[model samples]
Target: MTELVPTPNNCVLPRIRADFATFNDAIDYAAKSEKGMNFHDMRGTLTRVYPYSEMRADAVQMAYRLVDAGIGKADRVALIAETGPDFAALFCACTLAGAWPVPLPLPTTFGGKDSYIDQLSVQLQSADPKVLIYPPEIAEMAAAAAERQGCEGVDWDTFAQRPAPEVELPKADPEDICYLQYSSGSTRFPQGVAVTHAALLHNLYGHAASMDIGNNDRVVSWLPWYHDMGLVGCFLSLIANQVSADYLKTEHFARRPLAWLDLISRNEGTTLSYSPTFGYDICARRISSQSNVEERFDLSRWRTAGNGADMIRPDVMQNFVNAFSAAGFKASAFTPSYGLAEATLAVTVMPPGEGISVELVEEERLSGTRRDLSRPARYRAIVNCGKPLPDMDVEIRGENGEVKSHHQIGKVWCRGPSVMHSYFRNQEATDECLVPSEDGKGAWLDTGDMGYVDAKGYLFIVGRAKDMIIINGKNHWPQDIEWAVEQLPGFNHGDIAAFAVETENGEEAPAVLVHCRVSDPDERVKLRDEIRDKVRAITGMNCVVELVPPRTLPRTSSGKLSRAKAKKLYLSGEIEPFRLAA
Candidate 1:
């Protein structure tokens, strides 16, 4: 019968500049502060208050244990990202021991046992980590994955309990590789993004400065630690910037999403929290109809509700404002950003207090197709993800490497100190994305995403070039097709995935796989036909539509629908859609 108190929102520590020589240096400074991390239960009640001082001590112990086990400098230690004190300590321990910590995603509910194991196995094979540590609950699957990769696997509890003799820990320089981050969708072909200590610190500095983080600012997050935004933006950034933060386990938030808001309500002066569009959509749908929005929450102090990790949905943002306005939530609190693991984290962050702003562009322009007079003009709302960080340079470059004018859509390219060192041991892939500069300033990263910057310098993202479906020499974005189907009745976000599939006549056509909630065979056929017609009307051509059961489509680790994986599974007959009557 012990009462748990969360960490204080404001600490007495003097706000230090994030100009550390290395990540370990950042941790050493943060350890002097009274601030720390707070953990919450499923119900949003406080469970643990971990001080930075204690965390440093625990990390040192963990580092000694790792060194005793012959895991030293430059070794790869893959850790299953479970939001808790243990994972936090071990992550810091890796940096302290001069080993690289590779944070991997936990088993998601969407993918069953075999799928999760396969994912881990592939990633392990790529990383070739010296050891894989995971929570005991997933030891069976973790061990299986490790065995497949021929590496040592141990539950974190058992590993932590091992004896540790005092040993010399290797020191890391600014140029040293601190960790490897795998992009959310990098499963079948995993490419670990190698980040240097200087790059990591630089990104954290830019992110903290972008938000104008004050001593009173604290973060409340439920984002998975495996993703870039969750790891660098929330976890590592806090330690570097000496900010106290609170957390709810990502899985627990999935089960009880409202708990995320409840913790925000409970924590006074909690100013910053981030998620993809789906997180806001879920919370809005969960509480929109309830008349007790004000009774259930107090969000007046929630200053920055950051949006990233996927396309920013303006409709979803408006819906969230409508749903939560009664609880003192301001529409201006939305802080949308654009970034990837390749940049370590925040390449561009929306200026605080600027809510979601979007531009309505012609659909044909977005798809890079000529508009036909016979068809009605359609428009897509492209969200403005904001300007680049202080050290970052943004450009829209054509295929020929010439930079395009403002408002002219092309590939998004960025260069900065925060850009990743390289793709781990994959020089070919590294060279493909990171094109070196003739002036030798640095390499510019081909973001693979298509976007344009406005005259005022704000970035507006179109879509991914790789996700485009080409048919008869015209380009079609899958988002447009999927959004067209989403307008039909009884549909939801992530319910449809659009990709190019080969037709019987050897022609390529857009194929939409929709989540069918209806169980009746007749109704299912009707639904498929409706979806097909809707897609055809938008794309001006016939499309193949298949009705699949709910949650049948695959999602990346960060919960974004994986169109590439969906197509692979569907073509391989792994995802058998509902049969339509012949």
Candidate 2:
């Protein structure tokens, strides 16, 4: 017996019309082809190959099972979005049942069971899920969370075994809700962005057209399925475009970051993969000491290496390109993109082969400081996150809600057919951010991001609007201070969190929370002082520096540092800091 080779690089399937009214339509069309998803392990070995035909079959059965279990159209079905066939089938099953599938993050990285349960309870309360499906491995935590939310938690095995009663499946309409995508919570608390079928399809079409995605492209991803990039971009986009995809669990990738590239190397097709800055940074650092990287990996076929989810770090991307260029990697393959869950994943994408273009804006301008004509301009390299996708409009709005000129940094806003209907059950948040466009044709979504667009239409994100620090009437970005501290030898990426704290007199002061690995008291004190001085030099103001144990900082579900959560923890004295002399 011989093992069958997976979908070959050159074997192109018949392209499906991407104008589907709903995700079920796309999946129905894709079920005609043998091309499907393959799951790989850290060793680059194929674990499972699930074709669309089987997936749809299982999903239909699951849909019947769900309907039998009293789940109906428009009902909320929550699933712990682990990267596997069960979750995939259940997600699509919800579509067939005309129910809204809400993806909840897995409980692997949240440190302890209680914290995971708390987080899960919060989301469950927000979603008000009719049923919570999770792998049996996490039954303890899942059961607790479900109980707290007054919902039933069913393991996948039990759910699969449920009786599929003969009932008519609810038909989906174009205007119906497609799914609920939770924002990554990098800056603020996570909110479920309500995406409709029409909006999702439009976004998918625009994304496919923007990337020029064809049958030749294959997707390889380790991003968590709960994230928009992983759920919409990698998963839904593949089904819509009839492209084959390879997946490794996000947890597996964390333990073996190089496996993502290895899977891409093993697949001869032109690979399309996206990751946040830390993903690339981790891979580069892990493999820096290894030799024969060229022989071990073949990144020549990787055509589009996408960067998003957090601030795009040019230095980290450069390191990755340089590290793998010997393996036929091209610098031009880098695609820095800008998006949020509110827009259903992609707002703008760098054209293929354009690489990453950056603007060296004066530091003061980046921080929203009024220019001093006589001061020497210190520049910061802001990565250009390409043009908006078709039908997507990008605008920079000033503090007064007026549209800003090109290169003038302000809050980023977008309006398009793909923009979300609203934040689920959070009218206050929706009202605060979503507003009517100038022409009153459609609503504009306040992205809550600070950025500017160049004359050529490339967008450069500066920082989070809520995270900006203002001192003595001058604006400063926390990322600027964090990035400067990252340049030190002992510090690695993601070792710092910067924010603003109010003093006893109600004056705002910049605060820095650094993850220190050094155990020596004197060295820790020196490190704190050095960080404080560095921040002061940049902002020209006193900053409070606190040294905390490594890995003490809070992170959002999508793995970006949650500065807002960190600030809350610090202010509440939950984050115990090491004693350091001022």
Which prediction has the highest TM-score against the true structure?
Answer: 1
Residue 475 of candidate 1: its Cα lDDT? 41
lDDT of 2 by residue, 386-492 (tens): 99999999999997899989888899999999999999898998999899776887999898889998888888898755675644323355776788688777998
Against the unseen true structure, what C-alpha lDDT does each candidate score?
A: 0.88, 0.83
Q: Which ten-residue region of model 1 has the weakest summed lDDT?
A: 468-477
**TM-scores of the candidates in the order shown:** 0.83, 0.82
Residue pairs of candidate 2 with colliding backbone atoms: none
State, as a TM-score between 0 and 1, how close model 1 is to the true structure.
0.83
lDDT of 2: 0.83
**Candidate 2, poorest ten consecutive residues by summed lDDT:** 182-191
- Tell how far residue 294 is off in model 1, in angstroms: 1.1
User: Candidate 1 regions off by >4 Å?
Assistant: 468-579
Cα deviation of 213 in candidate 2 (Å)?
Answer: 0.7
Q: Report the error of model 1 at residue 41, Å.
A: 0.9
